[model samples]
Target: MLLKELVDTAATVAATRSRLTKVEALADLLRRLPADEIAPAVGFLVGRARQGRVGVGWRQLSSVMGEPADAPTLTVADLDALLDRLLTTAGSGSAALRSTALRDLTSRATADEQDFVGRVLIGEMRTGALEGVLLDAVARAADAPGDAVRRAAMLTGDLGETARLALVDGPDAVAAVGLQVGRPVLPMLASTAADPASALEVTGEASVEWKLDGARIQVHRRGDDVHVYTRSLADITHRVPEVVDVVRSLAVDDVILDGETLSLDEDGAPRPFQDTMSRFGADAPRETLLRPWFFDVLHVDGRDLLDEPLSARLAELERVAAEHRIPGEVTADPAVAERVSREALAAGHEGIVVKGVDAPYAAGRRGKSWVKVKPVHTYDLVVLACEWGSGRRQGWLSNLHLGALDPQGEYGEPGGYVMVGKTFKGLTDELLRWQTEHFQSIETRRTAHVVHVEPTTVVEIALDGVQRSSRYPGGIALRFARVKGYRDDKRPQDADTVGALRALLPGA
Candidate 1:
């Protein structure tokens, strides 16, 4: 298939912002792909392609393709060619190409359609939902089982492999998919609900395990061999070797356990997220130095226990993780979750992910079934020009330039707004490194952490509150709006709309 056709389909999907349309676009793109290339293509889209991390953005892709110019230009056909190069290199390209390839495409996008294509390429394809929300759409389009297909893709990080197995070997391959990698069927990932009332309704129980804020690790054991994967299931067997040895020394032989791995000091105090992130960023992560706290279990003794309820699995995980478990842990009832949450925060974690004992493992699903109760604060802000980022974050143009919302158009200068603040906070350093590289690529001028881009990526920013200010584009300032992480699950258009800003004023 021609690259233009793929772009057109992508454009159609973005234009409609319909899940069905996006799935159809993916289906069309897959049909044109050779059987062998399908997995690589999907993996490239959803799974990241970075060293130590999963994404290096377009620059990495461009470098992989050997595109001319420090920053390359990409045509639609360029994506397929780019994928071919990535697969040929096994996605092991110099940093330059991978970063440029995605950005170059994003740089030239003029329409909503192009933006959609760009979103998919970067794995930011959020239409107000998580990736799993679209799995059913994909399955419907491809005429396959949504659950099996999503799980297979998670295990292999390749939608094409899932498709091929479904088409060639039958549902058996899809069923046995995670097993090939020695994983039990995918483990359930948990989150927390914002409202305690909502949490009670969802779990239908007075008991739950408040979740932790850290990287999710899934450990798969085969005899003595151990492979560990992140929440996205990318193999981190090398970066987290202590985890490998920890799992290796565990009492069980064939099992898969899910847990959180935070970089903690010997005192068992949780390190700053940055310190923990730096550990992950290290080419040689000191596994012995890196502490992993096991939280849950999904498989044991060749039996699938996801259906066995959280209470049973928790017990099972503890039995296997006997030697390697994080000490002083117990199942906290729902009423005490508030107390547990205090310990999580006091220990320097974000919040807790509460899980019900009776809930089955719902792989690749996030809803009230699994809530995410992030402690958030809101701020009213005006959109300013966007900027880019670096390293693993390259080509994203993830950073933002902010100003207070100027609703009256009351500025004496160009529209009455001032650039008051800039922040790289609330983002994983992985996010930071990736954005740093991205900002560098699109930099109009450079002196330090600032690089201006087209005012294309707008966002609804939440901060602890505002402070009196004179330094930034806005005379008034946001106390902590710092990139507050990303709105990848949202479109630039969907940013907190201007009408909503009035709520911040006492006498609006």
Candidate 2:
């Protein structure tokens, strides 16, 4: 497909405010694309190189600049050298320099590169601005039903492939392809039931399994080799070696198991979510210190259980886990989960996830089929000066007049104490006392009502609820928000942005 064709499609989607218009535009593009150009066509739609998901990093625009430290100093020096030129010179401020840069960028950049630039300038990078909406567009373009495209994309996670089947084969193409061997199925997740009655109504006669407080992992083992992926499907096999050992110990020669990877303390209780997340950072040791507990199996020996009922799959999971002594379960009773949750909380672990006993793996979604009920506490808050945050928050100072940023946006705007928010929920009382002293130093003005600070100090802010408010411009107000502590490790510009504040939608 031509680059202009894809650009037009993306631009059309972005310009159209309604979902209906976006879908129609996307479908129109798909219908017009030649069959042979399907893969490239989707590539155009994504404004990315045509590469498999497993190999997307090198295809990334920034990745084209080169690896960190090794990356170019003045300009992006690799495949994105052209892009670097556009970005570096795009902001000369000097009209002549700006004109030259724009001219050069126009001549040097590809059609897709132009689209990327347009999106970056506008702060909307992903195709159609939303993945779900775009996926629907791809289906419509192919003249296929949305369900078919959703299933294909969910199973494969390859928008390009999904686009292909949706365009050419229409809906039902996924089912017609027979079972995909080696292709991973999307894993299922848990949801929360408003109450026990609702939970029971949905479960019917099915069983409920306790959702453990741990990271979700997809375990793939074939023969003696094993691979593990995080919920985002990032390859983490090397980071969690203990999981590999467990899979190797499994009875089946080749099996794909769905489960959780959690850091269990010495007392056998899960650790903090932050701790679990931090374990796989850039600085984490490339060793298997994490533990993985198996819960379900979606594939075994090339046979797909995706269409199979949970009851049958549970039997398989039970047999394999038991035969191999892998940590997993098959019983639907909530008692085991209740015990797990109680024990987990006693040991400072997060609450449990209750899963459906018969649901197929519904990857890329969160619904009642899989339920999660975590215990979160709330605190009361007092409104301070509200300012904009950075990046997406440049004009609004959206960050809470946060007591803190790394500076959570408590900077002094011209007329008032404009700050985003502040927080260091990890700190102790000692930190809070230290923050008050530091905040006093930055004080520019003070009143009986509000103490105007220089925005130099930031204190951590924590709250439980948000209510509609005339107090804030975003049409909402914070509840139980106050300084938990402070973080001096960050700068004020590094504070939260207005975008973050908007994310606190009630239902969301």
Candidate 3:
């Protein structure tokens, strides 16, 4: 298929707010894709290239700008091959060589194709074709069940592969996809509530577990071999030997466990989140040991428990990994839920997560079946832009322009962020210095006083609440907002949404 067709469809999807229209447009495009181009086309439409990162940055991309081609001739396969070359390019003068290749590719693309390729390279699709919407489109194009497509996508952790199976191989092939022990599946996510009582109200007869402020890890063990993955499903087995050792010690021969890991001080208190992430991001195991705590079991022996209730999974978790189970209790009483929340806070943990006892694991989906409760209002927001500091803090990036996700384009572009507010508070001098350097590396454009960057960096922000305001496009502004820290573990899509912030309005 021609690149222009895909780009045109993406433009149509991004130009509207109606999800059904976006899905129909995408489905029509998907129906026309040949078997060979399905994967790359899906990846491009979703804004995530199959070749993860090709070592291309804003500086490299900017240096290779050129005039565009007049007519469309590039094919999807041609673009895929170009990405392959960029991914494999390396060594002493590889940077210059890669730039030459990028220039050649861009010189052949039209204006619209150039814009689409640039956005895809920078990891900003901004097309309303989010994974959910695209999954529905795939189902529509294949005339398959939506649930089957969703389940296959969740189990395989690859939307491109799922699309191929649904559109080419048939619905039977898509439904045949199941949980594999070694392959990492998409982890289930949670919604938020004000407190444990409120969370319990949503999830009756719940398991209220400690919500630790640590890095999320998924451990898969078969025999003595174990692989650890981050929340984004990047393999980090070699960096966390301690976690591997813990998983290896389990009695079961094969298991899949979902949990958190963090370094602890001498008194058994969890260390600062940054300290833990620093170790977690290292290529090799550091001196600081990270301890793993298992909360839910997805697979044990040869049976997959993802379709089972939480109560059944907990029983299996207790039986196999009892020593490493996170602290929690199964209760329906609100007072007990509150007690667990208090205990978690006292232990220097975040708060509690109330999970419905009867709900099956809904992988890769965030719903009310599991609700997180924290005493303070904290949200993960994207850094849209940063302002140049002044006075004593001159020459540094101080004020941060924060944005919340708008998945449905209710306020603006679909799958884009809505600016909520700005903040210069809670940033130490060290943080300011770091951001000034970091933001420049990813800078997209700049003004005299502000440096606009790619909307990828995620920072946790604490706020009193939100109030109705005409100052921002989202119809609400943050109150008393301050940075808690940068969340290196999360992606821009994982940030809280504008609707989530609006939910904090008075009498909402």
Most lDDT-accurate candidate: 3
lDDT of 3 by residue, 66-138 (tens): 9889999988988888899999998999988888889998899999999888888878778888999999999
TM-scores of the candidates in the order shown: 0.64, 0.64, 0.98
Off by over 4 Å in 3: none
Q: Tell me how far the alpha carbon of residue 235 in candidate 2 is from the true structure, in angstroms, after superposition.
A: 1.6
Residue 116 accuracy (lDDT) in model 2: 50
Best to worst by TM-score, what's the order?
Answer: 3, 1, 2
> Clashes in candidate 3: how many?
0
**Best TM-score among the predictions, by candidate number:** 3
Evaluated at residue 383, the lDDT of candidate 1 is 36
In angstroms, the error of model 1 at 239 is 2.7
Task: Sort all candidates by lDDT, best to worst.
Answer: 3, 2, 1
lDDT by residue (tens digit), candidate 2, 218-298: 888878878887765667777777778988887788788888776767776666544565566555664325777777788
Candidate 2 displacement at residue 283 in angstroms: 6.8
TM-score of 2: 0.64
Give residue 179's lDDT in candidate 3 (0 to 100): 89
